[model samples]
Target: MLVGIPLDQSNNTVKPKECASEMSAYIVEVAETRCKRSFAKVFNYFAPRLRSYALKQMGNEALAMELVQDTMSNVWQKAHLFNAEKGSPSTWIFTIARNIRFDMLRKLQNRKEDVCSDDLWPILCEQTADANEASLDQQVTLEQIGYMFESLPVKQKAVIEAIYIDGKSQQEVADELTIPLGTVKSRTRLALQRLKGMLHDND
Candidate 1:
Protein backbone atom coordinates (compact mmCIF):
# COMPACT_ATOMS: atom_id res chain seq x y z
CA MET A 1 0.00 0.00 0.00
CA LEU A 2 1.10 3.58 -0.56
CA VAL A 3 2.77 5.19 2.45
CA GLY A 4 2.02 8.73 1.34
CA ILE A 5 -0.82 10.42 -0.44
CA PRO A 6 -0.03 11.28 -4.05
CA LEU A 7 -0.26 14.80 -5.49
CA ASP A 8 -3.08 13.68 -7.77
CA GLN A 9 -4.94 10.42 -8.37
CA SER A 10 -7.23 11.47 -11.20
CA ASN A 11 -5.85 8.86 -13.60
CA ASN A 12 -6.26 6.09 -11.06
CA THR A 13 -10.00 5.74 -11.30
CA VAL A 14 -10.03 1.95 -10.82
CA LYS A 15 -7.72 1.65 -7.82
CA PRO A 16 -10.02 2.25 -4.83
CA LYS A 17 -11.72 -1.15 -4.58
CA GLU A 18 -9.63 -3.06 -7.11
CA CYS A 19 -7.68 -4.53 -4.20
CA ALA A 20 -10.52 -4.91 -1.78
CA SER A 21 -8.94 -7.92 -0.12
CA GLU A 22 -5.75 -5.99 0.49
CA MET A 23 -7.49 -2.81 1.66
CA SER A 24 -9.78 -4.89 3.83
CA ALA A 25 -6.72 -6.37 5.52
CA TYR A 26 -5.46 -2.87 6.31
CA ILE A 27 -8.81 -2.00 7.81
CA VAL A 28 -8.79 -5.18 9.88
CA GLU A 29 -5.28 -4.50 11.15
CA VAL A 30 -6.22 -0.97 12.12
CA ALA A 31 -9.22 -2.28 13.96
CA GLU A 32 -7.56 -5.14 15.85
CA THR A 33 -4.14 -3.71 16.66
CA ARG A 34 -4.54 0.04 16.18
CA CYS A 35 -1.61 -0.09 13.82
CA LYS A 36 -0.57 3.38 12.75
CA ARG A 37 1.06 2.00 9.61
CA SER A 38 -2.15 0.32 8.55
CA PHE A 39 -4.15 3.41 9.33
CA ALA A 40 -1.60 5.52 7.47
CA LYS A 41 -1.92 3.28 4.46
CA VAL A 42 -5.66 3.84 4.49
CA PHE A 43 -5.22 7.56 5.00
CA ASN A 44 -2.45 7.85 2.42
CA TYR A 45 -4.53 6.14 -0.21
CA PHE A 46 -7.93 7.70 0.46
CA ALA A 47 -7.30 11.15 1.94
CA PRO A 48 -6.46 12.84 -1.34
CA ARG A 49 -9.42 11.38 -3.19
CA LEU A 50 -11.75 12.14 -0.32
CA ARG A 51 -10.55 15.73 -0.27
CA SER A 52 -11.12 16.09 -3.97
CA TYR A 53 -14.58 14.60 -3.66
CA ALA A 54 -15.35 16.82 -0.72
CA LEU A 55 -13.93 19.87 -2.46
CA LYS A 56 -16.27 19.30 -5.37
CA GLN A 57 -19.20 18.96 -2.99
CA MET A 58 -18.34 21.66 -0.50
CA GLY A 59 -16.49 24.09 -2.81
CA ASN A 60 -13.84 25.16 -0.31
CA GLU A 61 -10.37 23.81 0.37
CA ALA A 62 -10.61 24.14 4.16
CA LEU A 63 -14.06 22.60 4.38
CA ALA A 64 -13.02 19.80 2.03
CA MET A 65 -10.02 19.01 4.23
CA GLU A 66 -12.29 18.94 7.26
CA LEU A 67 -14.47 16.35 5.57
CA VAL A 68 -11.40 14.22 4.93
CA GLN A 69 -10.27 14.46 8.56
CA ASP A 70 -13.71 13.71 9.92
CA THR A 71 -14.10 10.74 7.58
CA MET A 72 -10.73 9.18 8.42
CA SER A 73 -11.44 9.69 12.11
CA ASN A 74 -14.65 7.71 11.70
CA VAL A 75 -12.90 4.95 9.79
CA TRP A 76 -10.40 4.65 12.60
CA GLN A 77 -13.05 4.61 15.28
CA LYS A 78 -15.51 2.36 13.45
CA ALA A 79 -13.26 -0.04 11.56
CA HIS A 80 -14.52 -2.91 13.65
CA LEU A 81 -18.01 -2.23 12.40
CA PHE A 82 -17.09 -2.77 8.76
CA ASN A 83 -18.68 -5.74 7.01
CA ALA A 84 -16.95 -6.78 3.80
CA GLU A 85 -20.00 -8.74 2.67
CA LYS A 86 -22.04 -5.56 2.60
CA GLY A 87 -19.59 -3.13 0.95
CA SER A 88 -15.96 -2.40 0.32
CA PRO A 89 -13.97 0.22 2.22
CA SER A 90 -14.27 2.66 -0.69
CA THR A 91 -18.05 2.49 -0.52
CA TRP A 92 -18.13 2.75 3.24
CA ILE A 93 -15.64 5.59 3.37
CA PHE A 94 -17.22 7.61 0.58
CA THR A 95 -20.66 7.11 2.07
CA ILE A 96 -19.42 8.47 5.36
CA ALA A 97 -17.87 11.46 3.63
CA ARG A 98 -21.03 12.09 1.64
CA ASN A 99 -23.24 12.00 4.72
CA ILE A 100 -20.87 14.34 6.50
CA ARG A 101 -20.90 16.64 3.49
CA PHE A 102 -24.68 16.48 3.62
CA ASP A 103 -24.67 17.72 7.18
CA MET A 104 -22.15 20.39 6.28
CA LEU A 105 -24.38 21.51 3.44
CA ARG A 106 -27.37 21.57 5.72
CA LYS A 107 -25.50 23.94 8.00
CA LEU A 108 -24.14 26.07 5.18
CA GLN A 109 -27.45 26.33 3.40
CA ASN A 110 -29.57 27.31 6.39
CA ARG A 111 -31.15 30.13 4.40
CA LYS A 112 -31.72 27.96 1.32
CA GLU A 113 -33.81 25.26 2.92
CA ASP A 114 -36.26 25.62 0.06
CA VAL A 115 -33.53 24.15 -2.15
CA CYS A 116 -31.90 21.01 -0.78
CA SER A 117 -29.05 18.74 -1.85
CA ASP A 118 -30.98 15.61 -0.87
CA ASP A 119 -33.65 16.58 -3.36
CA LEU A 120 -31.05 16.88 -6.12
CA TRP A 121 -28.85 13.92 -5.18
CA PRO A 122 -30.03 11.05 -3.07
CA ILE A 123 -27.61 10.06 -0.32
CA LEU A 124 -26.31 6.48 -0.24
CA CYS A 125 -26.92 4.55 2.98
CA GLU A 126 -24.96 1.50 4.18
CA GLN A 127 -27.56 -0.05 6.42
CA THR A 128 -28.30 -3.75 6.21
CA ALA A 129 -31.80 -4.72 5.15
CA ASP A 130 -34.17 -6.24 7.64
CA ALA A 131 -35.48 -9.74 7.08
CA ASN A 132 -38.89 -8.47 6.04
CA GLU A 133 -37.96 -4.99 4.90
CA ALA A 134 -36.76 -3.87 1.51
CA SER A 135 -33.95 -1.39 1.16
CA LEU A 136 -32.64 0.91 -1.57
CA ASP A 137 -29.02 0.40 -0.74
CA GLN A 138 -26.96 0.82 -3.89
CA GLN A 139 -24.73 -2.12 -4.70
CA VAL A 140 -23.19 -0.13 -7.55
CA THR A 141 -19.54 0.46 -6.84
CA LEU A 142 -17.67 3.71 -7.40
CA GLU A 143 -16.11 2.36 -10.59
CA GLN A 144 -19.50 1.53 -12.03
CA ILE A 145 -20.71 5.04 -11.26
CA GLY A 146 -17.58 6.58 -12.78
CA TYR A 147 -18.21 4.83 -16.08
CA MET A 148 -21.96 5.41 -16.06
CA PHE A 149 -21.57 9.09 -15.27
CA GLU A 150 -19.15 9.46 -18.16
CA SER A 151 -21.80 8.19 -20.56
CA LEU A 152 -23.94 11.29 -20.17
CA PRO A 153 -23.99 14.06 -22.77
CA VAL A 154 -21.51 16.80 -22.05
CA LYS A 155 -24.04 19.41 -20.96
CA GLN A 156 -26.24 17.05 -19.03
CA LYS A 157 -23.24 15.31 -17.49
CA ALA A 158 -21.76 18.60 -16.32
CA VAL A 159 -25.01 19.55 -14.66
CA ILE A 160 -25.45 16.11 -13.13
CA GLU A 161 -21.91 15.91 -11.83
CA ALA A 162 -22.11 19.39 -10.38
CA ILE A 163 -25.47 18.90 -8.70
CA TYR A 164 -25.53 15.16 -8.08
CA ILE A 165 -22.04 13.84 -7.47
CA ASP A 166 -20.63 17.11 -6.18
CA GLY A 167 -23.64 17.83 -3.95
CA LYS A 168 -24.19 21.36 -5.28
CA SER A 169 -27.50 23.14 -5.11
CA GLN A 170 -29.23 23.69 -8.45
CA GLN A 171 -28.80 27.43 -8.05
CA GLU A 172 -25.16 26.99 -7.18
CA VAL A 173 -24.61 24.83 -10.22
CA ALA A 174 -26.37 27.34 -12.41
CA ASP A 175 -24.30 30.17 -11.04
CA GLU A 176 -21.04 28.25 -11.43
CA LEU A 177 -21.83 27.01 -14.88
CA THR A 178 -23.23 30.42 -15.92
CA ILE A 179 -26.44 28.85 -17.08
CA PRO A 180 -30.02 29.64 -16.31
CA LEU A 181 -31.45 28.03 -13.19
CA GLY A 182 -34.25 26.52 -15.23
CA THR A 183 -31.76 25.05 -17.67
CA VAL A 184 -29.89 23.47 -14.81
CA LYS A 185 -33.10 21.99 -13.48
CA SER A 186 -34.16 20.69 -16.90
CA ARG A 187 -30.81 19.06 -17.55
CA THR A 188 -30.73 17.56 -14.09
CA ARG A 189 -34.20 16.07 -14.48
CA LEU A 190 -33.36 14.58 -17.87
CA ALA A 191 -30.03 13.25 -16.67
CA LEU A 192 -31.60 11.55 -13.66
CA GLN A 193 -34.27 9.95 -15.81
CA ARG A 194 -31.61 8.51 -18.08
CA LEU A 195 -29.52 7.35 -15.15
CA LYS A 196 -32.44 5.61 -13.45
CA GLY A 197 -33.41 3.92 -16.70
CA MET A 198 -29.83 2.77 -17.15
CA LEU A 199 -29.75 1.44 -13.58
CA HIS A 200 -32.95 -0.54 -14.00
CA ASP A 201 -31.73 -1.88 -17.31
CA ASN A 202 -28.53 -2.99 -15.63
CA ASP A 203 -30.60 -4.78 -13.00
Candidate 2:
Protein backbone atom coordinates (compact mmCIF):
# COMPACT_ATOMS: atom_id res chain seq x y z
CA MET A 1 0.00 0.00 0.00
CA LEU A 2 1.15 3.54 -0.82
CA VAL A 3 1.96 5.26 2.45
CA GLY A 4 1.22 8.89 1.50
CA ILE A 5 -1.83 10.81 0.24
CA PRO A 6 -1.98 11.13 -3.52
CA LEU A 7 -1.82 14.55 -5.19
CA ASP A 8 -3.72 15.47 -8.38
CA GLN A 9 -1.34 16.21 -11.28
CA SER A 10 -3.51 15.38 -14.28
CA ASN A 11 -2.61 18.50 -16.26
CA ASN A 12 1.01 19.01 -15.22
CA THR A 13 4.02 17.96 -17.26
CA VAL A 14 6.92 18.71 -14.93
CA LYS A 15 10.34 18.91 -16.53
CA PRO A 16 13.33 17.26 -14.76
CA LYS A 17 14.63 20.46 -13.14
CA GLU A 18 11.09 21.53 -12.21
CA CYS A 19 10.41 18.11 -10.72
CA ALA A 20 13.54 18.40 -8.54
CA SER A 21 12.49 21.85 -7.37
CA GLU A 22 8.98 20.54 -6.66
CA MET A 23 10.36 17.63 -4.65
CA SER A 24 12.39 20.01 -2.52
CA ALA A 25 9.35 22.17 -1.94
CA TYR A 26 7.20 19.13 -1.17
CA ILE A 27 9.74 17.89 1.41
CA VAL A 28 9.61 21.30 3.06
CA GLU A 29 5.80 21.09 3.15
CA VAL A 30 5.94 17.62 4.63
CA ALA A 31 8.28 18.90 7.31
CA GLU A 32 6.18 21.93 8.16
CA THR A 33 2.68 20.41 8.09
CA ARG A 34 3.00 16.66 7.61
CA CYS A 35 1.39 17.20 4.23
CA LYS A 36 0.47 13.85 2.71
CA ARG A 37 0.23 15.12 -0.83
CA SER A 38 3.78 16.45 -0.66
CA PHE A 39 5.02 13.24 0.92
CA ALA A 40 3.27 11.29 -1.83
CA LYS A 41 5.05 13.30 -4.49
CA VAL A 42 8.43 12.70 -2.85
CA PHE A 43 7.72 8.98 -2.48
CA ASN A 44 6.50 8.63 -6.07
CA TYR A 45 9.65 10.24 -7.38
CA PHE A 46 12.20 8.42 -5.20
CA ALA A 47 10.70 4.98 -4.52
CA PRO A 48 11.71 3.36 -7.81
CA ARG A 49 15.31 4.59 -7.67
CA LEU A 50 15.55 3.49 -4.05
CA ARG A 51 14.26 0.04 -5.00
CA SER A 52 16.96 -0.29 -7.64
CA TYR A 53 19.60 0.75 -5.08
CA ALA A 54 18.35 -1.87 -2.59
CA LEU A 55 18.28 -4.55 -5.27
CA LYS A 56 21.92 -3.85 -6.14
CA GLN A 57 22.94 -4.16 -2.49
CA MET A 58 20.98 -7.32 -1.59
CA GLY A 59 20.02 -8.89 -4.94
CA ASN A 60 16.53 -9.80 -3.68
CA GLU A 61 13.46 -8.25 -5.33
CA ALA A 62 11.07 -8.65 -2.37
CA LEU A 63 13.65 -7.42 0.15
CA ALA A 64 14.53 -4.51 -2.13
CA MET A 65 10.86 -3.45 -2.32
CA GLU A 66 10.58 -3.78 1.45
CA LEU A 67 13.64 -1.57 1.88
CA VAL A 68 12.08 1.10 -0.35
CA GLN A 69 8.87 1.03 1.72
CA ASP A 70 10.78 1.31 5.00
CA THR A 71 12.98 4.11 3.64
CA MET A 72 9.92 6.11 2.55
CA SER A 73 8.34 5.50 5.93
CA ASN A 74 11.47 7.00 7.50
CA VAL A 75 11.22 10.01 5.17
CA TRP A 76 7.62 10.54 6.22
CA GLN A 77 8.51 10.30 9.90
CA LYS A 78 11.74 12.26 9.83
CA ALA A 79 10.98 14.96 7.29
CA HIS A 80 11.51 17.58 9.91
CA LEU A 81 15.15 16.56 10.29
CA PHE A 82 15.96 17.24 6.63
CA ASN A 83 17.80 20.46 5.83
CA ALA A 84 18.14 21.54 2.21
CA GLU A 85 21.10 23.73 3.12
CA LYS A 86 23.11 20.64 4.04
CA GLY A 87 22.33 18.36 1.06
CA SER A 88 20.01 17.69 -1.81
CA PRO A 89 16.76 15.72 -1.44
CA SER A 90 18.20 12.82 -3.43
CA THR A 91 21.25 12.58 -1.18
CA TRP A 92 19.09 12.62 1.95
CA ILE A 93 16.74 9.94 0.57
CA PHE A 94 19.58 7.74 -0.68
CA THR A 95 21.35 8.00 2.68
CA ILE A 96 18.16 6.81 4.37
CA ALA A 97 17.91 3.91 1.93
CA ARG A 98 21.56 2.95 2.57
CA ASN A 99 21.04 2.99 6.34
CA ILE A 100 17.89 0.85 6.11
CA ARG A 101 19.71 -1.69 3.94
CA PHE A 102 22.51 -1.80 6.52
CA ASP A 103 19.99 -2.36 9.31
CA MET A 104 18.36 -5.22 7.41
CA LEU A 105 21.70 -6.93 6.80
CA ARG A 106 22.68 -6.54 10.46
CA LYS A 107 19.37 -8.04 11.60
CA LEU A 108 19.83 -10.99 9.23
CA GLN A 109 23.33 -11.59 10.65
CA ASN A 110 22.03 -11.43 14.22
CA ARG A 111 19.34 -13.99 13.43
CA LYS A 112 21.87 -16.36 11.90
CA GLU A 113 24.13 -16.25 14.97
CA ASP A 114 22.89 -18.42 17.85
CA VAL A 115 23.92 -16.20 20.73
CA CYS A 116 23.41 -18.82 23.39
CA SER A 117 25.53 -21.36 21.57
CA ASP A 118 28.15 -18.73 20.80
CA ASP A 119 28.38 -17.80 24.47
CA LEU A 120 28.55 -21.45 25.56
CA TRP A 121 31.37 -22.32 23.18
CA PRO A 122 33.40 -19.29 24.14
CA ILE A 123 33.10 -20.28 27.82
CA LEU A 124 34.18 -23.85 27.02
CA CYS A 125 37.38 -22.73 25.30
CA GLU A 126 40.62 -22.38 27.22
CA GLN A 127 40.99 -18.74 28.15
CA THR A 128 44.58 -17.68 27.65
CA ALA A 129 43.83 -14.02 27.08
CA ASP A 130 41.54 -11.73 29.07
CA ALA A 131 38.33 -11.29 27.03
CA ASN A 132 37.26 -8.19 28.95
CA GLU A 133 40.61 -6.48 28.39
CA ALA A 134 40.53 -7.42 24.70
CA SER A 135 37.00 -6.10 24.37
CA LEU A 136 37.95 -2.82 26.06
CA ASP A 137 40.91 -2.42 23.73
CA GLN A 138 38.68 -3.08 20.74
CA GLN A 139 36.16 -0.48 21.94
CA VAL A 140 38.89 2.12 22.36
CA THR A 141 40.35 1.31 18.96
CA LEU A 142 36.95 1.63 17.29
CA GLU A 143 36.34 5.00 18.96
CA GLN A 144 39.68 6.32 17.74
CA ILE A 145 39.03 5.00 14.25
CA GLY A 146 35.68 6.76 14.16
CA TYR A 147 37.32 10.03 15.18
CA MET A 148 39.95 9.59 12.49
CA PHE A 149 37.25 8.91 9.93
CA GLU A 150 35.54 12.18 10.80
CA SER A 151 38.75 14.10 10.18
CA LEU A 152 39.03 13.06 6.53
CA PRO A 153 37.91 15.43 3.76
CA VAL A 154 34.35 14.94 2.54
CA LYS A 155 35.26 13.33 -0.79
CA GLN A 156 37.88 11.08 0.82
CA LYS A 157 35.45 10.08 3.58
CA ALA A 158 32.76 9.28 1.05
CA VAL A 159 35.16 7.15 -1.00
CA ILE A 160 36.28 5.21 2.07
CA GLU A 161 32.74 4.65 3.28
CA ALA A 162 31.62 3.42 -0.13
CA ILE A 163 34.57 1.08 -0.54
CA TYR A 164 34.88 -0.24 3.02
CA ILE A 165 31.80 0.40 5.14
CA ASP A 166 29.31 -0.02 2.31
CA GLY A 167 31.31 -2.94 0.81
CA LYS A 168 31.36 -1.63 -2.71
CA SER A 169 34.20 -2.34 -5.15
CA GLN A 170 36.34 0.56 -6.39
CA GLN A 171 34.67 0.46 -9.80
CA GLU A 172 31.24 0.37 -8.18
CA VAL A 173 32.10 3.33 -5.96
CA ALA A 174 33.37 5.30 -8.96
CA ASP A 175 30.24 4.47 -10.95
CA GLU A 176 27.94 5.40 -8.09
CA LEU A 177 29.78 8.62 -7.29
CA THR A 178 30.16 9.42 -11.03
CA ILE A 179 33.92 9.76 -10.67
CA PRO A 180 36.70 8.06 -12.58
CA LEU A 181 37.93 4.69 -11.28
CA GLY A 182 41.44 6.07 -10.83
CA THR A 183 40.12 8.89 -8.64
CA VAL A 184 38.31 6.40 -6.45
CA LYS A 185 41.49 4.35 -6.02
CA SER A 186 43.59 7.41 -5.25
CA ARG A 187 41.13 8.69 -2.67
CA THR A 188 40.87 5.28 -1.03
CA ARG A 189 44.64 5.00 -0.85
CA LEU A 190 45.03 8.49 0.60
CA ALA A 191 42.25 7.95 3.11
CA LEU A 192 43.71 4.62 4.21
CA GLN A 193 47.17 6.12 4.58
CA ARG A 194 45.83 8.89 6.80
CA LEU A 195 43.80 6.46 8.89
CA LYS A 196 46.78 4.16 9.28
CA GLY A 197 48.94 7.05 10.42
CA MET A 198 46.34 7.95 13.03
CA LEU A 199 46.15 4.37 14.23
CA HIS A 200 49.90 4.13 14.46
CA ASP A 201 50.03 7.31 16.51
CA ASN A 202 47.53 5.79 18.91
CA ASP A 203 49.62 2.63 19.21
Candidate 3:
Protein backbone atom coordinates (compact mmCIF):
# COMPACT_ATOMS: atom_id res chain seq x y z
CA MET A 1 0.00 0.00 0.00
CA LEU A 2 1.03 3.62 -0.56
CA VAL A 3 2.12 5.22 2.71
CA GLY A 4 0.73 8.22 4.60
CA ILE A 5 -2.24 10.21 3.27
CA PRO A 6 -3.37 10.20 -0.36
CA LEU A 7 -1.49 12.30 -2.94
CA ASP A 8 -4.42 14.65 -3.46
CA GLN A 9 -2.97 17.02 -0.88
CA SER A 10 0.79 16.94 -1.58
CA ASN A 11 1.10 16.28 -5.36
CA ASN A 12 -0.48 19.45 -6.67
CA THR A 13 1.96 21.33 -4.45
CA VAL A 14 5.07 20.53 -6.59
CA LYS A 15 6.22 20.30 -10.22
CA PRO A 16 7.81 17.15 -11.75
CA LYS A 17 11.55 16.56 -12.09
CA GLU A 18 13.28 14.90 -15.06
CA CYS A 19 14.97 11.45 -14.86
CA ALA A 20 15.31 9.14 -11.91
CA SER A 21 18.14 8.14 -9.57
CA GLU A 22 18.38 6.85 -5.99
CA MET A 23 15.31 7.59 -3.83
CA SER A 24 17.04 10.43 -1.96
CA ALA A 25 18.23 12.07 -5.16
CA TYR A 26 14.83 11.57 -6.75
CA ILE A 27 13.17 13.15 -3.74
CA VAL A 28 15.50 16.14 -3.83
CA GLU A 29 15.00 16.69 -7.53
CA VAL A 30 11.25 16.23 -7.28
CA ALA A 31 10.97 18.88 -4.59
CA GLU A 32 13.31 21.21 -6.49
CA THR A 33 11.30 20.79 -9.70
CA ARG A 34 8.00 21.02 -7.75
CA CYS A 35 6.86 17.60 -8.91
CA LYS A 36 3.90 17.18 -6.58
CA ARG A 37 2.73 13.81 -7.93
CA SER A 38 6.24 12.34 -7.79
CA PHE A 39 6.73 13.64 -4.28
CA ALA A 40 3.44 12.15 -3.06
CA LYS A 41 4.15 8.85 -4.81
CA VAL A 42 7.53 8.61 -3.15
CA PHE A 43 6.05 9.51 0.25
CA ASN A 44 3.37 6.84 -0.09
CA TYR A 45 5.89 4.16 -1.03
CA PHE A 46 7.96 4.70 2.08
CA ALA A 47 5.41 5.81 4.69
CA PRO A 48 3.95 2.47 5.86
CA ARG A 49 7.25 0.76 6.57
CA LEU A 50 8.58 3.90 8.17
CA ARG A 51 5.51 4.14 10.39
CA SER A 52 5.86 0.50 11.49
CA TYR A 53 9.51 1.01 12.27
CA ALA A 54 8.77 4.13 14.28
CA LEU A 55 5.95 2.45 16.17
CA LYS A 56 8.14 -0.54 17.03
CA GLN A 57 10.69 1.77 18.62
CA MET A 58 8.26 4.24 20.24
CA GLY A 59 5.35 1.94 21.17
CA ASN A 60 2.79 4.40 19.80
CA GLU A 61 1.16 4.00 16.39
CA ALA A 62 -0.33 7.48 16.18
CA LEU A 63 2.92 9.11 17.20
CA ALA A 64 4.83 6.98 14.71
CA MET A 65 2.46 7.96 11.90
CA GLU A 66 2.91 11.57 12.85
CA LEU A 67 6.66 11.09 12.74
CA VAL A 68 6.34 9.49 9.30
CA GLN A 69 4.47 12.54 8.01
CA ASP A 70 7.00 14.84 9.61
CA THR A 71 9.87 12.88 8.05
CA MET A 72 8.26 13.07 4.60
CA SER A 73 7.79 16.79 4.99
CA ASN A 74 11.42 17.13 5.97
CA VAL A 75 12.37 15.08 2.92
CA TRP A 76 10.49 17.50 0.71
CA GLN A 77 12.04 20.52 2.38
CA LYS A 78 15.57 19.11 2.66
CA ALA A 79 15.87 17.07 -0.55
CA HIS A 80 18.54 19.42 -1.72
CA LEU A 81 20.83 18.22 1.06
CA PHE A 82 20.73 14.61 -0.17
CA ASN A 83 23.93 13.24 -1.75
CA ALA A 84 23.33 10.12 -3.89
CA GLU A 85 27.02 9.22 -4.15
CA LYS A 86 27.22 8.61 -0.41
CA GLY A 87 24.34 6.13 0.09
CA SER A 88 21.26 4.39 -1.24
CA PRO A 89 17.86 6.15 -1.23
CA SER A 90 16.33 3.78 1.36
CA THR A 91 19.33 4.27 3.64
CA TRP A 92 19.00 8.04 3.47
CA ILE A 93 15.27 7.88 4.11
CA PHE A 94 15.77 5.49 7.06
CA THR A 95 18.41 7.78 8.53
CA ILE A 96 15.84 10.54 8.51
CA ALA A 97 13.33 8.24 10.25
CA ARG A 98 15.94 7.21 12.85
CA ASN A 99 16.81 10.83 13.60
CA ILE A 100 13.15 11.67 14.03
CA ARG A 101 12.69 8.75 16.43
CA PHE A 102 15.69 9.81 18.53
CA ASP A 103 14.41 13.39 18.61
CA MET A 104 11.00 12.19 19.82
CA LEU A 105 12.61 10.11 22.57
CA ARG A 106 14.63 13.11 23.71
CA LYS A 107 11.52 15.29 23.77
CA LEU A 108 9.62 12.66 25.75
CA GLN A 109 12.35 12.62 28.39
CA ASN A 110 11.86 16.37 29.05
CA ARG A 111 8.14 15.91 29.83
CA LYS A 112 6.96 14.55 33.23
CA GLU A 113 5.51 11.05 33.15
CA ASP A 114 1.88 10.46 34.26
CA VAL A 115 2.17 6.65 34.50
CA CYS A 116 3.28 5.04 37.76
CA SER A 117 6.73 3.46 37.92
CA ASP A 118 5.13 0.08 38.75
CA ASP A 119 3.19 0.17 35.46
CA LEU A 120 6.43 0.37 33.49
CA TRP A 121 8.14 -2.55 35.21
CA PRO A 122 6.07 -5.21 33.44
CA ILE A 123 6.97 -3.82 30.06
CA LEU A 124 10.63 -3.75 31.04
CA CYS A 125 10.44 -7.32 32.32
CA GLU A 126 8.72 -8.42 29.10
CA GLN A 127 11.67 -7.11 27.15
CA THR A 128 14.06 -8.93 29.47
CA ALA A 129 12.07 -12.18 29.19
CA ASP A 130 12.23 -11.93 25.40
CA ALA A 131 16.02 -11.75 25.58
CA ASN A 132 16.15 -14.76 27.91
CA GLU A 133 13.91 -16.83 25.61
CA ALA A 134 16.15 -16.06 22.68
CA SER A 135 19.19 -17.32 24.62
CA LEU A 136 17.42 -20.59 25.59
CA ASP A 137 16.50 -21.04 21.91
CA GLN A 138 20.17 -21.06 20.95
CA GLN A 139 20.90 -23.93 23.35
CA VAL A 140 17.82 -25.80 22.11
CA THR A 141 19.33 -25.81 18.61
CA LEU A 142 21.38 -28.88 19.55
CA GLU A 143 18.50 -30.80 17.94
CA GLN A 144 19.33 -29.36 14.51
CA ILE A 145 22.73 -31.02 14.69
CA GLY A 146 21.00 -34.19 15.92
CA TYR A 147 18.57 -34.10 12.98
CA MET A 148 21.44 -33.73 10.52
CA PHE A 149 23.19 -36.66 12.19
CA GLU A 150 20.09 -38.88 11.86
CA SER A 151 19.43 -38.01 8.19
CA LEU A 152 22.23 -40.12 6.71
CA PRO A 153 22.63 -43.64 5.32
CA VAL A 154 21.78 -46.36 7.84
CA LYS A 155 25.39 -47.39 8.48
CA GLN A 156 26.91 -43.96 7.94
CA LYS A 157 24.09 -42.17 9.78
CA ALA A 158 23.91 -44.74 12.55
CA VAL A 159 27.62 -44.68 13.27
CA ILE A 160 27.75 -40.87 13.34
CA GLU A 161 24.55 -40.52 15.41
CA ALA A 162 25.76 -43.14 17.91
CA ILE A 163 29.17 -41.58 18.28
CA TYR A 164 28.09 -37.89 18.24
CA ILE A 165 24.41 -37.62 19.16
CA ASP A 166 24.13 -40.69 21.40
CA GLY A 167 27.51 -39.93 23.08
CA LYS A 168 29.09 -43.32 22.22
CA SER A 169 32.80 -43.79 21.48
CA GLN A 170 34.07 -44.81 18.03
CA GLN A 171 34.76 -48.39 19.20
CA GLU A 172 31.30 -48.54 20.77
CA VAL A 173 29.61 -47.46 17.52
CA ALA A 174 31.72 -49.94 15.51
CA ASP A 175 30.91 -52.72 17.97
CA GLU A 176 27.20 -51.85 17.98
CA LEU A 177 27.04 -51.63 14.17
CA THR A 178 29.16 -54.84 13.97
CA ILE A 179 31.53 -53.09 11.51
CA PRO A 180 35.33 -52.97 11.74
CA LEU A 181 36.84 -49.97 13.64
CA GLY A 182 38.58 -48.76 10.45
CA THR A 183 35.37 -49.21 8.42
CA VAL A 184 33.44 -47.12 10.96
CA LYS A 185 36.07 -44.38 10.82
CA SER A 186 36.14 -44.42 7.00
CA ARG A 187 32.35 -44.27 6.70
CA THR A 188 32.08 -41.39 9.19
CA ARG A 189 34.75 -39.35 7.37
CA LEU A 190 33.22 -39.96 3.91
CA ALA A 191 29.71 -39.14 5.21
CA LEU A 192 30.87 -35.85 6.70
CA GLN A 193 32.69 -34.84 3.48
CA ARG A 194 29.63 -35.62 1.37
CA LEU A 195 27.39 -33.70 3.75
CA LYS A 196 29.66 -30.64 3.57
CA GLY A 197 29.75 -30.80 -0.24
CA MET A 198 25.96 -31.06 -0.39
CA LEU A 199 25.59 -28.07 1.91
CA HIS A 200 28.05 -25.94 -0.06
CA ASP A 201 26.42 -26.86 -3.35
CA ASN A 202 22.99 -25.92 -1.96
CA ASP A 203 24.33 -22.56 -0.91
Q: Which residue pairs in model 1 clash with each other?
A: none
Clash count for each candidate, listed in order shown: 0, 0, 8
Lowest summed lDDT window (length 10), candidate 3: 121-130
Looking at candidate 3, what is the lDDT of residue 202?
42
- Per-model C-alpha lDDT, please? 0.79, 0.78, 0.67
Give the per-residue lDDT digits (tens) of candidate 3, residues 115-138.
Answer: 432243321112332234333222
lDDT tens digits, residue span 74-147, model 2: 78887887777876788778777766676588686776532332133321223444455433332245777889
- Sort the predicted structures by lDDT, highest score first: 1, 2, 3
- The candidate, 1 or 3, that scores higher on TM-score is 1
What TM-score would each prediction reach against the true structure? 0.48, 0.49, 0.43
Prediction RMSDs, each to the true structure: 21.4, 22.2, 17.4
Q: Candidate 1: TM-score?
A: 0.48
> What tens digits encode model 1's per-residue C-alpha lDDT throughout 87-199?
88888788778777877877876764544443543333345334675577557877877888899899999998887678999999999999899999999899989888777
Candidate 2 stretches greater than 4 Å from native: 1-16, 111-203
Show the lowest summed lDDT stretch of 10 residues, model 2.
116-125
Colliding pairs, model 3: 3-44, 11-36, 14-34, 14-35, 14-36, 15-34, 15-35, 16-35
